[model samples]
Target: MAEVRTVAIVEDDPIIGASLAQRFAIEGITTQWWRSGEEALAGFARHRPQVVVCDIRLPDLDGESLFGRSTRLLGPVPFLFITAFGDIEQAVRLVRAGA
Candidate 1:
């Protein structure tokens, strides 16, 4: 089994990001919490985390766009996307796009 070393948290909400990061820390997984999609992209280029926990609506770019761009850069890293505002159409689109 491969150990999960790092997780990237891309969320605009401070509390959510901090909570996730704390949990990962407890499990001995290093986490990088990025507040916006743009910042996350930069971090992804540098850190290349084993997994990503992201919020769908970011200040700069939406989660789907970020995922698309990230895939080009990092190639199929796992992303667990979350959103407070649920949109069925958007969800379906994401599913179709391999989200």
Candidate 2:
């Protein structure tokens, strides 16, 4: 059987984070939900999820920086940014920059 992919979700909103985590759980995928970028970064070394779902507006560290740091640590894993702000320009920039 193929290995199940692990996914890390970095979102400040408890409701959304929990919902996303639950969704992954229902799909039988491993998930780690973090409320802050710092928390995610700290645990990333141990978890090393193949995919990361991050919110752009975090408490201490923003998603852009988090994505960059994650890439540096794990060598460019897939990152899916989620934000209510919905800034297309910024998203384009992030994607162009390899986030």
Candidate 3:
């Protein structure tokens, strides 16, 4: 919200990813957009984003797993999970687990 330092977007959808990147750029929020779980992991470690915007279903690692790994590595940084999928169960589990 308030001038985010940096954000990592782990979204495989090209259109969504690009649109988010553009919007963040407009707000002067630096972003690193990764298309897969593997890429997101690598880039997350490298960039150390202040926040992460990730999709629930990824090509390699899936969002729940990625969120777990990211929390361990990043020390509880904020993560926002975006999903177009209709799987409400998984999302609810994550939310209840305090993800």
Candidate 4:
């Protein structure tokens, strides 16, 4: 069987983070849930997940900045941004800037 893809989630909201992690788990995808960008970056080297789902607002750093740095380190893995309803425009701008 082909290996399942691994996913990393960087979200501050506990409920959302856990729910997403659980959903991925149920689908047989490996997931690592992080509450802060700093925590996520610190362990990213070890985890090396194939996809990253990150909330735009984080305690330590914004998801855009984290995504940029992660791309530098990990060479452009897929990134999905989770933004507040009001921040959708800002998220789009970030995505256009290569975040």
lDDT of each: 0.90, 0.90, 0.87, 0.85
CA lDDT for candidate 2: 0.90
* Candidate 3 residue 18 C-alpha distance from true site, Å: 0.2
In the range 1-99, model 4's lDDT, one tens digit per residue, is 546588999999999999999999999898989899889888798889888999988989988789888887888778888877537678678778775
- Residues 48-91, model 1: lDDT tens digits: 99988889999999999998999899998888889888599988
Clash count for candidate 2 is 0
Q: On a 0 to 100 scale, what is the lDDT of residue 87 in model 3? A: 75
What candidate 4 gets wrong by more than 4 Å, as runs, is 1-4, 85-89
Q: Candidate 3: how many backbone clashes? A: 0
Rate residue 15 of model 3 by lDDT: 94
Candidate 2: tens digits of C-alpha lDDT, residues 1-99: 546589999999999999999999999999988899899999898889888999999999989999889898888788999998868899889989887
Give the Å shift of residue 34 in candidate 4.
1.0
Q: How much does candidate 3 score in TM-score?
A: 0.90
**Model 1, global lDDT:** 0.90
Better model by lDDT, 1 or 3? Answer: 1
